[model samples]
Each structure stands twice: as structure tokens, then as C-alpha cells.
Target: MELSILIVDDDKLLVDKLEETVQWEKIGISMVFTAYNIRQAQKLLEEFPIQFLLCDIDMPQGSGLELLEWIRDNQMEVECVFLSSYANFAYAQKALRLSAREYLLKPISNQDLEAVLSRIIEETREKRERRSAEEQNLGQQRKGKTEFWEDFFRNPSEQERMLAQVLEEGFYQETDVLILEVIKIFADDKDINYKKDLSLFNFVIRNITTEFFENNEQVMEAVAQVSDYEWVLVFRNLGEEERFLEASGDLKKHLNKILPQRSCMYIGETRPLKETAVGWKQIEIMEKKILPGTDGILCERDISEQDQMLSGNAAYRLPPWEIWQKTLHNSEDLDGVCRNICDFLKETFAKGVLTIENLERFLRELEQLVYCYLGEQQMSFSQLFDSREFDRRERDSFHSLDAAVGFVEWIFGTIKGRGNSRRSQEDVVSQVKDYIEGHLNEELSRGILAKMVYLSEDYVSKLFKNTTGMSLPGYIANRRMEKAKDYLEHSSLPVSRIAMEVGYSNFSYFSKTFRDFTGMTPNEYRNHMTKNSSDKK
Candidate 1:
């Protein structure tokens, strides 16, 4: 997800060698992606944050130059260095036209590559700084009282400390604070898009609320934007509870005339300046308990009912996701574990014992835990989740308490689906592995291996890569070399015989492969093992 570099080449062997020899981490790059062709490289570019591309000029299916063209066409911000085997002036001219970092001839030295990369990294850093400066300039333009209020709630006491300076030029009663939670407001069918017309939405919420309460003789009111979706209004010198609440009821009627949601008046309890922030937090936390269509003015006193419900019973409370994670890890009791979780969720959401906020919070935490566990296996969550679109109904909010029950059950089913796919992948890889071990003395070409597993060569290759992060050829080579090492160390067989045993007819070629794999020739490895055995004796 962080900054990375991608290396694309049609020659898998060349790709392997380049990856093995490159000191990517030493050159301040921790992530380097490799692809055999342009399509795979394009997918990586879309999903991951790639800063640079070290791509060969020619590849199968699509060339690196074509990939560069696609990147430029998209106006994507990625620096590319072209690697070509030829010294064609036409290619050079095209590379220059595409604004490539450099057109490097094949067989460039590592030092030269490193030097080129260092320059690119410097340029990348400068590009990032320039972008950050531009964003900061825009942020400064947007910064004002709204930004101040957002910061104030995060560190309430500290911001309250700045009250004096803020009020030096302007005056207000900072004693009583009202935190208002704004949900969606649909104005009219054609002009009611909040996402597209966010400024208009913001204007209606703030400007209207300010005008409604500004000149009330009982209160000196000041409202400021707390977040994009919420605002805080501070009222001063307002005394009686009944009269204030009556005024609030009238205020709600006015708000309803212009807004969509009746719960827009979701207000916090009045508090002194020292305790006002506590009031703000209380209102937000209490909002989690408010059911849709069952609302009036919500006060701190309304929270006690939900608190009593949760504290009164274990099944009524939020599920502990960490415990579920442990259960999923050693999932002998998966059905029972999931069943219990779902039953409790049914009781919580279906019975209206938990608030929407808590339900969402719990579900989000559950998703995060699943993501963390899968990420450790080098699995992609978006790849797993986004590819499978949920039914449109599943995307909507729980309209009824019974619907909320169904929502929680659906979440467990989704997780189980992920687990099932993981199991299926393991089974496929396991069968292929069995074939590999049984046919170690025979040719294990991708074609041969794919037939053994009843899959096409390309399918087998992709499956192996997805499961083990190893190309079919790379994995087969690793297996062969591992067998060779074991034979050299533990058996009295000649190097030639051992090479043949590992399915290599040419002993010299086998020796070269062994050296490439382990940095030692077969005979040298045998000698080293004999010397070590003697020393041990």
C-alpha cells in the first residue's frame, strides 16, 4: 500500500535474476513488484501505490512501451525507466517522447542501475513535497472556524484554553455546548445529492441552525461545524429546562421543514464550560442507542435505559472479536463459535438492545481482524471482497429490527465464505504438491504438472503463484535444487548420478543450476559437507 517500484519483463528467468540481484531495500525501496507482461503490471499499478516502473521494452501479449503509453494516457503519476535489448534510435526517440526516466540498454551494470534509481528516488521525493505543499495551500484556504471546532472536540480542554483568544474579537457564551449529529438530508429528487453538492448541504445545516437560534432573548447561541456531518452549538444564559425543551421542539419543527431526517435535532445535555466537552461525547455515544423513527429530543437521561439493557445481560452486549479470531485460527469449533456469535447478534440487533453505532463498530472491528489475519498470509482483502458484489439489499441499512438480525447473520456467512475459499485453495495446492513429490525423478514441466492435476498449464501456474508466491518454474527449480542438496550431503552417490536422479541428464547443466540456486556447485557442496562431517567427528 505504501510507495513501491514495479519490474516487468517477458523473460521469467530474467525477472527472477533481476529480483535476486537487486538491492532494493538497501536503496530505500522496501516494496518491488514483478510482472511477466503489461497486463499483470497494469493490475498492480491500479491496486498498489507504485512510484516507479523498471520495465523491459518488449514483452509477450503487450510491450512495456504500450504499458507506458497507457499510464500516460491515464495521466497517472509514475516514473518509468525503459529497459531494451536493442539500440534502436527510433525506440530511443519514442522513449524520449513518452517522457521516460531513461532508455537503458540491456546488460547495464548494477551500479549504473542503482545510480539511476537514486536520481529517480530524489525526484520522487521532490514530487511528493510539491504535491504536499499544494494540498497545504488548499487546506489553508479551507481552514477557518470549522477547522478550529473540529480540533477543539478532539482535545477539548486544550481548545477550551484558547477560548479567551478566540473571543477577544468576538463574544459568545461558551458555557453550554450542543453537539448535533447530521445524517443525510435529501432536498429534492434532482438536486439532492449530498456527495456532489456537499457545500450546499453544509450551508443548509449550519446557516439555518444559526439563524433559528441566533436572536433568542433567553440564549446567546453560536454554532460551528464539528465535522462534515456534524455541528456543535453553544448556548448562553438559557435557564429553565421546560421552556428550553419547548423551544427545541419548535426548533425541530422548523428543521424538519427543510431537512429529511427527524433525528437531526440529536442534541447533547447542557453543561458548564468545564464539562461541556463531556456533554458532546455523551451525546455522540448515546446516539448509538437511538432507533430510527423512534425519536424526539434525546438527552443524557435516555442513555441509562440502553446501558441498563447491556449491563443487565452478557448476551445483550457487543461480541468480543478477538475471541472469535482465536476460534477461527484453531477452528475445530467453527460452526459452534459462529452460531453463538450470530445468536448473540440476533439478540442484540433484532431485540433493539444495541445501538446502530455499536453494531457498526463491532462489525468494522470484526472485518479488520479478518483482514489482519489474511494479510499475514499475504492475501488481499479487496481482491477477496470487492470481486464478489453483494446483493443490493445487503448494502442497505437495517430497516427493521428483524432486518438487523439478518445483517449480522450475513456478516458471519461472508467470513465463512472467505474461509471456504481459503480451504479450497489449500486443497488444490496440496494435490499439486503430492504430484510433485511422486514425480521428482520425472520431468516436472508446467505442462506435465498441469496434466497431473487436471488443470491447464496457465491455470496451474497462476494457482501456484497465488497460493505460494512462486511461479511454476521457480517452484519446480527450488524443489529440484533442494533434492540435489539433500543427496549431496547425505548420500555417497556421484554428482552425475545425483544430477540424473533429480531429472537432469546433463551433469554440467545441473551443477550450474545448483550454483545459481545455492551459490555453490554440487561437487563443492559435497566437499563442504564432508569437511563439516569430519570436523563434527
Candidate 2:
């Protein structure tokens, strides 16, 4: 559990005091290093394998906060605790952003300092245990072909050279190696929630691969996380050029079938292993063109050397990602937005601007986005896209532009026709009712609800009664009562608090209303459920 500690502070006196006072050896801390600036600390890092860093927020040359930020940006693993004399909340907030373990005030306390160091020591021990476990896994990898592969990539010892020579003499001459580069975006930025996104990517890719190239085996593959936003998958498959091209259509179609939502992909052309770097560069170029929030399966043929040139330094390169994200965030009618995008694609194709590969890639990106939308809406894409039955509302949104433009015109004309009665009072009434039920704790008067839905109070009130056969207040109370009954039975919240939660300010009135509704007060309801449960037991 011994740890190497680095202290980065400008104060020589404090550094000497800390080094002398702290019982380093007894606590399993062997080495203590000091630096006044980030550059010096970095040099020290190279010289000594430091485990934890105690950094001062303010320094003469550079602050400790700056050093921590640099470390985080570079994906450095050393744990850091911030020490600052200035009582600045902003600095502390920034430190927290960098995931600093602890923030300490100036003139550090002996007890506080010791406690923090002890915690870091334990953490370092845990990290060592985890690394030890991984080392065992890596050791297993050193057996079989993986060892040879690792040696080929990591180092060039005599054994690695001998293996290469053997391969060159045997299967290397007969085998036609083609590299399949699968680039994944957003590999970093996952934070604690990366598993969800990673699982989705894995699930979609598995389905696509199975549906398309079922038996076609890939060889000598390499998959790496390129960045937080991307993944690069190099599939070295055992196949000739013709076989690869022949499977392309099925591959594209299967991707369409499997990933029917928004996700973009740029597939590079299959090339011989000698041209691996050339093929990989094509995928890399596509990455620069990939717009945020876009999902499509694209081929290398879809991109031109000219497109790359034009895409250079343009303010309006149309970040596929930004537009794709906006398409979901800005539009209430997601289907309409998607259809608009499709129509845009169709029009762009007519202009001969898009290659078949680019179009397919764009479609894949669209499919992933749509999948995300479906997930958010608690709907299944299969259920929505199934051929047997279709949702009329969503289907209607996909009409030709002529049809959509005409309808929009018709709606606009109709708005002009009865002094803009297109804003349906019924729509306002339904929206208000749903909104009130959602925000039950708020003071929801007819005036507030009307203003929210952009309608007159009188109009909203009349429409409310017309639709539900009750006044707005009565509807709210009934809904609140229903929710209260469920919470009362299941939750341990006090009856009085439950009353307030359900929008009843007066606990006595809530009890009376509860009794009136169910012939039992909130407390009585809870007791009845409890007694019934005991009887069942």
C-alpha cells in the first residue's frame, strides 16, 4: 500500500514542515516530491512514478488548479486534492469540475491532512488490486495468438520478428488481407453513464452484423477507442475484393433494418493490408465531415477529395451532429423533422451532390437518432415501423412536400379565416389539464393555466367542462385524490405531508375530502391496507 506523493506548492517553509511532521514511512508512504509549477511537477512525474498529488490553488508561476486541469485533459490517472488559501467558491467549483478528491483551506490542519492522506492511501491500494487482476487477464492474453499479436504491435523483439518471418513464408502469400475500419464516435464523454450508450452501440452492431454478413469471417481485427466521441474498429477479414463488394448491399440493407434510428457511420472501402493506412485515412477524413448527432452508414465513395476541400474552414459546413441533435430538441414533431430531413436528402440527391455511400451513412445516422427518440418516448421502433399496421399520425407526417406545403398553407389560410381559430380551445384545455396534473404542487389557477397554454381563462374553462364533463378544479381534486390513495398505501410519507403534496394546503380539508371520496381518511386508508396485508401474511 506504499504510495509516492507529490506536493506542488511555492511555500518552501510549509513544504519543509509537511515533509518533517508527516510520519511518511509508518503510513506506507515511501517518497515525497515537491514542485512549484506545472512544468516542474511534470518533470518530477517523469522521474518518479507518483500516485497522489497535493496541489496549492494559488502559486507564483502557475496555480495547482491549472496543473490538475492539464492532468485531467491529458487523461492522467494521479489522484489530486486541492489546497488553497483564497476562500473562493468559484475556484472550488472549478476544482470539483476536475474531480479533485478534497478541497482544503489555507493553513492546513494536521488531523485533516492526515485523514485525507489515509483515504488516498486506501484508494491507491484498491487501484493496485484492480491492476493486479487486470495483469492476470493480460497474462492469459499472452498465451495463444493474442501474445504474438500483442508482440507484433507493442514491440519488435527477435521472437516477434521470427513469427513475422514465418507468417510471411506461409499463409501471408496465399491470404488476401482486407482491413475493415469501424469508427465509433463518442467513446469518451461517457462518464458514469457510458455503459448505457456502449450497450446500445454493441447491441445495434451485433444485430446489423448478424443480419447482413452472417458467415463471412473477419480476421486480424483491431478495435480501439479513438476518443470519447468516437471508436475505430479495424476488421482484417479473410476475403477477396469481389466477395467484399458483393456483400456490401446486404450489409447496407441489414444496417437499415437493424438500426432504423439516427446514427451515422462512414465505411471505408476494402483494401489490401499493404494499403491499410490509405483505407484508414479515408475513414479519418469522414470523421472530420461527421456532423454531431448524425447517424448514417456511409461508404468511402460518397466522399470526394473536393468535398474535403470545400468543407474546410466553412462557417456553414452543416455539422451533421448539431443539426441532428437540434432536430430532436427543437422539433415537437419528430416524425416531421425526420421526413423533412429525408426530403432534403432526396432533393440533394437530385442535385447529384450526394454519393450512394454518403446517403447510406446519413440514413444510418438518422436511424440511431430515431432509435434514441423512440427510447425517450417509451415506444419501440419495431412496433412503430412494422409493415402490418402503422400509426396514422406518424404516417401522415411523411407525406410528399407538395402535400405538406399544401396542408401548411391550408392551416395558415384557416387561421386567417376565423380570426385565427386554428389555435383549438380543446387542445389548450387538454394541455392545461395534463400540465396541472404533472405540476400538482404548484398553485394552478385557471388564469395561470390559460396563460401557460396561451389561451384566455374563460375559453380554457368552458373547453375544460365541454371535454371532461366537470369543472377544472373538480378534475384536479379527483386526480389528486387518486394519486393520494396510491401514495398513502405504498409510501411512508406523513398523512399531513401527503395532503400538501397532493395540493391540499389544509390537512383537515384533505382528510375530509379523502373520507368523502373513499369513505376513509388518509390515515384510515393506510391502516386498512396495513391490516389487510397482516391478514394475508
Candidate 3:
């Protein structure tokens, strides 16, 4: 491939010197573009097929960091290196966050510049080559393997035929021992739309799983997305089971860091090629029995103990919902009532007697009690909680004991808040607004803010909207955009820095939000303010 590079610096002399001194053609750069400022750089970036960017961090109109942030927001894939005279750690940190290739000091020697360019060229080439290889491999081998597994799992009657065909095609051997590993993805965070992004998430997860096991010589791995949030990894040939388990633990940790959702991995026992279907079924059963938030690597033994405890145990019983309901109605001490419920749940969890069945029944009984109480007050559940959020919380409550307790507490607290006077309601809203104002630079979610004021997220959201004439999220976005505009007009901070100041870690998301709010990008907004100021002067 013909490689191209763009040189951006406000210093005309430095730009001229680098362009003249660097042997672009000798170092495999087929084209070189020069720009004096961020605007010029952005125009050239839009117009040309530049593969690499050699930019100065400091510029007059805008910093290179701002330009890179724009490039990222536009989804442009360009390798970048920053050149700065000062060894400022803040600048370096920003550059790193922007995925810059390297940070070099100014007055760079020709030899050093050439070496950096050559290394970048090689790395880019390798990446493209690897991507091409992956595409071809996916087209050829992965399709067949995935199709085979799908047939084997979905059509039990054809499992034998599929296995025979794969064995005949050398995809697997009769002598090989196979192990099935299943990864179940859960949308642990309320903000994640699991169904909407399941395909993309599955693709990324499959790639990560493939790469992690690529170096292992003991097993030949094949990964398939068998369901919306579940992936099945089939490992061929027998190896050290302990080693595989250790690696599975590491893979779980790696995935937890990289993936936005939580995942649980189940490793099935080794089986012959013919019994692969059975092994897959065993893992599926294990998955259904395990709780939602049960993360980490689970093995056959783990599932067996869980099955025994769930089926054989009869000592676990539901919480005393009838008495709790009477207490809630007769007592003015709502906090004490909530405390008692949480305490019971904590004690049950500590005893390890909290089975999923009993926990679910307890939740059902609690909901009934709450509904009956609300009916007595001529109020409905929908009036206090958003139906969708309520359903999500109920599903999440099944994940763990802590989650169940939290749901119970949130429910009772919400009911308590409903009985409060108008003045107290206004006070809660005031507290939430104050919290939002003070923590604009930190992450502010409805759940966090609601917890701070001891109310349900739905109740707080409705109160904020009723009091402020805007939804809670809408208010936060407006405040953030307003702060960003003030900074753009008054300070010389980079757009990325402004984004961080407004509680946005992602420059692209921040820019998109800003544009959505103001109908102009941050740079455009800043330029507009500048033009208006000049006109007034």
C-alpha cells in the first residue's frame, strides 16, 4: 500500500524544515501534506487519504489535541505522533488518551523522525495484514465451523450427521476429546441496551476469546455465538485441565476490563467428538440454574453443588412479607422497617440458604404487599415507578443477595417518600439539584443521585422534572453544554479538556452531545463566539 503522512505545526519554519529534511520517499511515505493550523489540518485530513499524522501539540488557533479529538469524533482512523517542546505530563496524558502513536520532543533529529515513521509504517502494515487475514479466515473456516455447531446444537437429530461431516472434513477427529465452554453475557448496568448491541458485543467478544486462546497449543478452539448473549467455545484435544482453568480465570478478568457488560464462563467436562452435543447441553443446564450476577469461571463441580443445594434443601423459606406489610402500615418508623428487611436478606445470604426459587417467591410476595398497600392509598405502582425501570430492577434483583436487598430498600424508601409532605418533596429536589451542580466534573447518574437523597431513581427523576420543568437527564445535558460553552468562550482549554470538565470521558460522545444541544460542534461554537465578540468590539 502507498503510505501518506500529514505534517501539522503552527511554526512555519519548523514545518518547512521537517518537510525538506525528512526523506519521505526513502522511508516509504508516498505523499506528504503540510498544514499551519488545526483548521488547515482538518481540511487536509478531510480531503486527502492521509494514513499518518505528525502534529505539534501547541498551536495558535487550536491545539493538536483538539484536532485529534475532532478526528476521533469523525471516526477517522489515523496514526498520530505529537511533537512538543515542553515535556508536559498533562499534554502527554491527553495525547495518550487520544491514542497517539508516540510523543516526541521538539527539535527532533532527522534520524529519530525517520525511525519513528518507519516503525509506524511497519506496525500499520502488520495491522492491516492481520485484519485481511482475519477476514479471509472468517470467510472460509469460521463460517463452516459456526454452521456446524449451530446445526449440531439446534438440530439434535442431525447432530450425528454434522459431527460425521466435520470429522470427514478434518475439522475434528473421532479420537479428539472436546470441551465446551460457554460465556453468558449480562447487562449488569441499566444503561446498556443488551438486545440492541448484542451482535457487535458478540463479535468483539469472539475476537477476544480467539486471540486469548490462539497461543495455547494444548487445544484447538472454535467459538460460536449460539444465542443473543451466550457464546459457545469448543476446544478440541485433551490438555492440562488445571492450566485451562487458570487461563479461563485470566480470560474472565481480561474480559471484565474490556467488555461493557458482565460475563460468566462455564467450562464443561471433556467428552469425545460424538458426545460434544451432550457436553453443550450440560453447559446449558448449568447456565439456567446459576443466578444472573454469578460472574467468574464456573466448572462442573460448582454447578453440581448449586443443583444439590437448590433441589435437596427444604429449610430455606420466604421472608415474612405479611408481618412486614402490617408493620409498614402501622409504624411511622419507615427506615427501621427497611433496615429489618435488609438485615433479614443479609442474614439469609450469609447462611447460603437463599435459593433462587425462594428469593423469587419472596420478591413476588413483597410486590403483592406493596401493591395492596398502594391500593389502600388510592395510588398505583405506575404512579411512583416507571414500568420499564421497575421491570429491569426486578430482573436485576435476581442477580445477587445485595441486589435483592437494594431493590427492597428502594421500594420501601420510594413508598415512604410518597407519604412525605410537599415541603419535604421540594427539599429532596433541591438536594438533588445541588448535588448535580457540585459534581458536574464527576459522573452523575440518576441512581447515584437518587441514592444520595435516599429516594428511588424514578421518584427523584419525576420530582426533578416536575420542579425544574425538565427531565433529570435533560437537565444534566443542558448544564453540561452550558458549562462547555462558557469554557469555550472564556478559556483556552482544548475541546477534550472541556469534555472532561463536563463529566464526559469520551470526546466523541461529548462532541455529539454538544452538537445535539447547540446545533454546532464545539470548535464551530467557539468560532461563532469569537466572531460575535469581534463584531461587538
Candidate 4:
């Protein structure tokens, strides 16, 4: 494929020499375009579909830095290589800031120039393939129903224009864009892991894109990134200001669900995208004040509201543990202790940005304490609930706490109830043991015992194991083997019928367990018992 090169320099003689002597055609460069200043370069950028831009930093009209700034502002896809004569570190540093691909000092060597050209040639080949795929995406974009994000990355300029056009096609022809930034704050000690950060970026992006796609098919196009350990979700909105606010609130809820365990998200409010320069100006200011700045999606309103609430004061509150520990003594009131502990937890959740996991730890520890208290006094939460005999009106209050505290509290409470239930829970176990011994020929699962005792299969299984050191099946097998031996010694029952009399429908499983428990199988033991009985007779 033929390569195109654009050289921006005011040195007529040097340009002539480089143009004539170099085998540009041999290296695959076919057409070359020249621009003397930043103005001419801007015109060339708009008009010609040039591949490589080799520009001198010090130009007569305007420097290459100004041209680079323009490219960044317009979101243009271009790789720049800087050229300058004077040995200035500051200029090179500024060039690096602009993301210049390479820096070369001007008294240019043909060999170094050739090397740069070769590198550009290789890069352009890849760019050509990317450009081809981008064109295909552009074709898809014209269909109006394709995924906006896929096309958005390929042609950002076209996407911004299309979003504007679609909004015009819709209710409002004139609209302002709001750029909201979401920052996530992490634990201070550890540096952010990149892979995890990227995963978070993808997760939040999926949420934002899905939410927008669900609500507004036209105006709410968005993009997300993980930059400097912060997850940034940028949205393009052209709807009512109130609608955007509502969307921001919904997005925050969405963020909560994705990383409920560890991250706290702070969202900034939507600002005018038209004023992108000003919006960018606010980015540093916003970053300075944002909480949970590392992983959250925060709008401008989030930061401003927090600022107003704190009123420029650094908000530092005591940890829940320290607060609970202070002015503490051995208190016998279980209800008072539980309330104090729960209040401490609630305060931590509100003020300290506790993750869902840490909140769960607090609940678990609290429940463990409750269980220890109950066990010492021989009582249960269920008994307390049942004794209250809460009317239908008061029952709703339980549901409210159940919902607010979430499934963790319910589980912890249930575990505590199970621990209390065990002391008086063996009546059913005794009955079950009697029934199993009486009916050895019948199938004896935890389910059957549960039915007999009026309990769940799971509860009965746990209860049986907790009450008896041996498992139900193991105890039943041992009992059946003992009965079979008695029948063999005293009665003239056939070995098969004796096996049937014992709990062996298959007899093989029974024999295996019997042999495993004792030294012999059921048949072998029965034969020995019969021989001994015959000898005694």
C-alpha cells in the first residue's frame, strides 16, 4: 500500500534536500504534503487524509505545540513526531505532555529521519487496518440501531455529531451537554491493582450503557475509563435537566450493586459538554474534593453537596469499635447492648464509608454476642418474637428492619436461634430413635424422621448429628446388625429373611456397613451365632 507523509517545516532548502535525495518511494511513501505553520497544518488536517505528521516545533506562524493542542481539543486521531533545532529540555518536556510520538533535534540526520519514516510506515499499516474497520463501523452506525459504544470508539467525532443530530431529530433542537465524573476511593495503604480497576471500569460502563439504552435510545450515549485508579463514566445527555438528575441518582444505585462489598462511589453532577474547556477546568478541582474518589461514579452535585455539608471542614469521625468501647462496662441489659451496638454500626455506615462486607462483619459479630448472651441465660430471639405475639400492625416493623438490615441479619438471627433450640431440641430425636429401632426394615432417612417429628429435613439432620455423636444412618446400621445376630442365634429364620428383617432392602449396602462396623459381614456373623447356639444346645 502507498503511504502519505505530511512534513510541517519552514526550512525551504532543508525540505527540498530531504524531498529530492531520500528514496521516499522505495520506502513505500508515495505522496508527501507540506505545511509551514500550525494554521496550514490545521487546514491540511481537515482536508487531506494524511497518514504521518512530521512537524517542526518552532515554526514562523505558530508552533507545533499549538497544533497538538488543537488535535487533542477536537479529539482528532493523529500521531505527532516533534522536530526542533535548539537543545531545550523544557520544549521536549512540553512535547511529551502533548503525547508526541517522538522527539528529534533539527540538524536532522538522513539515517535518523529514515528510521523515523520506517517506524511511521509500520504504524500507518496498522492504522490503515483500523481505519478500514472503522469505516465498516461507520456503515453500521448509519443503520441507527447498532451498538453506539462500538461505533463511538472508532469515530468519536462522528458519534458526538450523531448524538447532537439525533437530539435535534427528537424533541429539542438546542441542547447542552453535561460531563459527570465518578471517583472511587480505596483503602489508603495499598496501591490500586490495574486489572481490578479495569474490571471495575467495564462493570460501571456496562451499568451506565445498559441504563441509558433502557431509558433514552437517543441522547444518552456514554463512555467509561479507569484513569489514575479512578473509574470515569462520561455521558452525553440532551434531555431535560431534571431527567438527567434522575438518571444520575439511578446510576448511583446501579454503582452500589456492582461493588457493594468494597467500593464507595462519589458522583459529580452533569455539566455542559459544550463548555468542555471549562468542564475540564473543573476536573482537577472536583478530583481534589471527591470522596471514595478511586472507584465511585460521582456527579458535580455529589461533591458540591458534600462540600456544603462539611462547609470546608475535614470530617473525621471515630471508628465504630472505638466509639462502642469508650465508657463501656459489663451491662446485663441485652436489649440495651444490642441497640447501642446497632446504633454504632448505623453511624459507621453513614459516616465512615463502610463497605457492605465490613457492615456484614459488624452484624455477624453483634449476632455472635447476642447468641453468647442467650446461651448463658437459656433463651432465643424466636422465643422473644413469639412471646411478643406481635399483631399484624407491629409485624410490619419487623419486615422493615429485616429489609433494612438485609439477609445477613436474618441469617445471623437464625443461626443464633438454632444454637438456642438445641438444648430442648432432643425430644424429637428420642422419638425418632425409638421409631428407627422398632422399624429396622423401613427406610430411615432424615426426611422420614423429620416427618415423624414435624420438622424440616435439614433441621432434623442437623439435630440428629448434634444430639448423637454417631450419624443417624451409622446408628441405624449398628442397631440392625445387632438385631440380625439375635435372630440368627434364637430363631430359625433363613439368612435372606433375617437380612430382610434387618434394614437391608438390597442387603449388600447393609453387609458393607456391618462389616465396616464389626469384624464380619451379616451372613458370616449370623452363621457363627447359629453354630455357637447349636453347640450350646
Best by TM-score: 3
Model 1, which residues run further than 4 Å from truth? 1-151, 154-157, 163-196, 214-220, 253-257, 260-263, 288-293, 305-352, 361-537
Per-residue lDDT for 1-537 in model 3, tens only? 898999999899999998998999988998889999999999999998889999998888999999999999998989999999989999999999999999999777999989998999899989999999998986777667777776677777787788888789887778988888888776633455655577667766778777787755443456777777777887877578888877877888888797765567788888898888777767765555434333456687454444544354636566777777787678756788789888887777656556566677777777888788878766667656766667777776765555678788878777777667324667878878888888999989988886676455777788788888999988888888899999999999999999999999999999999999999999999999999999999
Clashes of each: 0, 42, 0, 25
Where does model 4 exceed 4 Å of error? 1-178, 181-208, 211-214, 217-220, 223-232, 237-239, 248-266, 271-300, 303-336, 343-412, 419-537
What lDDT does each candidate get? 0.67, 0.61, 0.79, 0.59
- Please give each candidate's TM-score: 0.32, 0.34, 0.55, 0.32
The list of candidate 2 runs beyond 4 A from truth reads 1-176, 183-194, 202-214, 217-220, 240-261, 290-295, 302-346, 349-430, 434-478, 482-523, 526-537
Q: Which candidate gets the maximum lDDT versus the true structure?
A: 3
Better of 1 and 4 by lDDT: 1
Ranking by lDDT: 3, 1, 2, 4
TM-score, cand. 4 vs. native: 0.32
RMSD of each: 23.5, 23.6, 14.2, 23.0
Cα lDDT tens digits for candidate 4, 1-537: 566777888887776777777778877789888777778878988887776678888877888888888888977767788878977899889889988888898787887888887877777788878999996986565334324434533454575675565566672234556554444433222224546756655665556545654564434334434343344445566456566556655655665576422343444455554454345445544444323322244345444444532243444333354333332225443334445555554564455344333433444565455455556556554433321222221221122222324333433344444444454567767888899988998788765775565445655666688889778877887798888778867888876787788867776776676787668876788788778878999
Displacement of the residue 523 alpha carbon in candidate 3, Å: 16
Lowest summed lDDT across 10 adjacent residues in model 1 is found at 387-396
